[model samples]
Target: MPKIIRDLEKKIFNTSMELFLENGYEGVDMKMIAKKCSIAVGTLYNYYPNKKELYIAILNESWNDTFKRFDKLKTLQLTPREKVEKAILMLYEDIEKRRGLGKELLNKNIKDLIEDARVSEFKKALIKNMEMSISCLEKKEAYKDDNSINIRLAEILLVSIPILIESHRHEKEENIRFLNEMLDGFIL
Candidate 1:
């Protein structure tokens, strides 16, 4: 009789995500992931042909999860300011859950990971989401010298700020305060 493993794929996915975030792309391999997953190396290979393919799967799953949560926020009848604030707060909580692993991973962009088409689309989707969310702000004039929304500033705000925050060692409260101080200038 063939054995059935309940949620084996999910177990692999979660374990691989943690390992990748902790050790980064270059530092992790299928055998290591197999050990962590409590499965045979052959079994791991059967599920994913290579590390890059597994990494791409993990990336797609994780990104889709974030986007799904944020999509809920987007549907709420909230002001743009409220939407952005809530979104960042939720992201901050996600960062807190990743206390040990996520920050260091941000600095190392694996070449193979970046070269993947899905990763490229992920980057584009991120920027487009920021643009649309910022465009929702009612105080468009507040963002500009000439009363037009300065999208470049919004881009910097959305993309660079979180990376900057994660790069430093700071307490959660301090990070929140710092983010609020930075965002207050634009929202006014």
Candidate 2:
């Protein structure tokens, strides 16, 4: 009979997140995670076959929280420009709040470890949200012949906003203004 270890899974999940944030994907190993959790490496593996699986799980959980505020956006009555601005701000603040984990996940070596489907899903969601905000524009007839502009713009903002935030080279307001100014030509 196996002995029951209360909260072992929870402990492993939390400990793994903390360690990954501090050391990054390459810096962490199963043995290191087990050491932090006060468990054997095999025990950690029993829950997560490899670091990648654990990382995906963590990303899934964390990203849900990151996008949580988006739900309320639907209920707000705002102009298209305001909606876009708010959406960018929301994303910026959320990523900034989790900068440590965000930076770790964005590391080149660490990104390769994550599956494409997971990364695509995250981008798809962001793009979808941005598209929704853009779609609210009354000037839909202007680009009726070419509808993909929304998707392309969404992708651009989705990629650029995070990079700008992570760089710490500009203030949040500056990035927002820059993005809005750039968007004016296409959107406004």
Q: Which stretches of candidate 1 lie over 4 Å from their true place?
A: 1-6, 99-109, 138-170
Task: State model 2's lDDT.
Answer: 0.75
lDDT, candidate 2, 11-128, per-residue tens: 9999998888888777888999999988888889899999878977887788786566676786789877788888878877776665556454345565565446777576578678
Deviation (Å) of 151 in candidate 2: 1.6
Give the clashing pairs for model 1.
Answer: none
Please, what are the lDDT tens digits per residue for candidate 1 over residues 1-188?
Answer: 64566898888888988897788777899999999988888888888999888887876666676678777888999978788777666666654555433332244466676666777787667656655666665443545554445465455655545564567556656666676567666666
- Model 1: lowest-lDDT 10 consecutive positions: 99-108
Structural similarity to truth (TM-score) of each candidate:
0.76, 0.78
Candidate closest to the true structure, highest TM-score: 2
